[model samples]
Target: MSSVASQVILHPNVSKSLKVLGTNLGRDKLYRAVQYFARFLAWYLVSRGYKVQGARWNALKSHLALARKLMRLGKPIEHLQAALRAAQIAAEPGEQITTICRQLGYFGYLTYDTLVWANAIKFFNFKPSTAEKVSKNANRLWLAGILFSITHGLLKAGRLANDVRKLQNAHLTEKGQDVDRDAKLGNLYNARDATRHQFIIDLLDVWIPASNLGFTNLNDGVLGIFGLITSLMAFRQQWLAVNGK
Candidate 1:
């Protein structure tokens, strides 16, 4: 498809951001960062005693698009937003009490995933189906890069470097949490070809929820997620040191 056809009408608020980032960063990666930043901001606002508004609205729109595409909900954004807002009001008097509200955990997760994926698609200029697999592929490369560079990067993660593939299929339950009680995402290591350099860049992203029981703040959630990443990196380093991969 032509670039124009694939190009999206990102929010007015985001146009300037793209302009600012133009030509200075890699393709798709820069936008992917923006999408993540957007999610972090939404969580940040909620933590700072503010309600999620525009971000939430656009978030719903993005997720709604996905749902419609996949034949899930098949509805417009306004209908869902109105319903969500009313439900939010009916759920709690304020942020102080939301537990009483009747809401599904999957809804919250879906919203977060949808918004992230939407921004990612818009920013990366890729379809959702394609972007969905990018991380997994990139992570595989990331793990390989670590092994190649160190030859023994697995011991640090408390596993052999060759076993890195396990993480790709592992779940929170399969791999018990560290002392922190925070679980890790599906896979942290990925091997991706950087859109800019064309040289491969190995990287990882470990997603953590804001709440343990569904009431934690975003910052803590991110920290917890990254904390796991830190361990993985550290372990990789240690394995390399010991094994000299």
Candidate 2:
């Protein structure tokens, strides 16, 4: 029994999962998954006339959201640092501009979101109107950040496509460079795949802030599913990164 127990504990998959859960990003993703699930479940229950159950799920979602906000208290500075780093790195003008803008947008969103969290916890005694305004601004900034991310992804995809075309054209004439050409193509393909994955995540996530800012009439159920999908996608990426897979 001890041998079996040790084997289970030492399993690679189990170890990797434990490593994933050990990180803040991993834990936050897991919580976000559950939170959005609760949101969708609450909406579904209420639509089916299960008022009491729906309320319970709604409470769960709210609590989890507050917890996530607390977890992200220091993230604004991280975005600011990223923006600073991007400014120093040499890249195409468009890439640098979009990256800096995206980071700044996220910095703004997280800064205002901190205020929202403080108000919720009574740490700050803002008026109802002020709180609402803060929340709206946070969502707007989040939406802007997501839009910038999408634009970055599109720009990257276009550049990758052009590189791919050039590589293919070079392959025809560069007979002795087959190995080098293939290696470069492989790297580019991997980058393209990663960019596409992030693009999809950004696309799904945009609707969440858009709905919050009243740009769309999407309901909680729809928004919940979108959040859930993007959370899982991000979670998977984080998991792979942690495991070096």
Candidate 3:
């Protein structure tokens, strides 16, 4: 298969984004470019007094900070811990309890899944049944991670929708009918709509096993490498069985 096809087969979301950008840049370079652009955009908006309403703004800031800290490659466990801290700080809003819980839950499941895969890969003399069991557990962990993400997206969107409703009701009560819309609240509603739409896309993406375990937005080079190794191991086992080795 072509390189592009291999990438699409292995990492559809990342490849799609790169295709959208119409760049021939390597995955790592493109990913870094996107992250830097996002960080710059967030800073520019905040500097211009544009902010997401309520604790959402803080959440955005925290994410930006987290991104800056992880701009360079580091230990996976350290990155996961930083992600957990960012999520906790972001969840300080009164209504984001569910969102935060889902974030933490995904990380937990992902860590478990990664560990299981590591064990299976490292254990050279794994019995066939043990390997099968590990594979089964990894699949379950992947599903759990996806479920947590879907739940988080749902709760976050719901909270924003509720805010929009309250804003609409208050406006109606004061003016006897809707007139000029509150821009801030309207933005929140729009954001909620976007989140719902993205969640649907995410659900589809997670059905693919190599989709970063649904814990991040960028290309996961590590997961891709691990997945490739796992595939080769499985293939090797199958070949051995066929050859009666």
Candidate 3 local lDDT, residue 14: 56
Candidate 1 on 1-245: residue-level lDDT in tens?
56654465565435644454343222233333334444555556666666756358337435543443333222234334544674556432332122212122223334444444555557436566765555344333333333332221222233322344554444555444432232222132221111111111112232232232233344533643343344444444443333345
lDDT tens digits, residues 86-173, model 2? 9999998887899999999999999999999999999999999999999999999999999999999999999999999899887355
> How displaced is residue 146 in candidate 3, in Å?
1.6
Candidates sorted on TM-score, descending: 2, 3, 1
> Where does candidate 2 stray beyond 4 Å?
1-10, 171-176
Q: TM-score of predicted model 3? A: 0.42
Instruction: Please report, as a residue range, the 10-residue window in candidate 2 with the lowest summed lDDT.
Output: 170-179
lDDT of candidate 3 over 129-233, digit per residue (tens)? 876665555555556555666776877777777777777777355663454556767689768866775576456536445443344444333333333343344
For each candidate, the alpha-carbon lDDT, in order, equals 0.37, 0.95, 0.51
Name the regions of candidate 3 deviating beyond 4 angstroms: 1-79, 90-101, 108-125, 172-181, 206-245
lDDT of 3 at 244: 38
Better of 2 and 3 by TM-score: 2
Clashing pairs in 3: none
Tell me the spans in candidate 1 whose CA falls farther than 4 Å from its real position.
1-25, 54-204, 207-245
TM-score winner: 2
How does candidate 1 score on lDDT? 0.37
lDDT of 2: 0.95
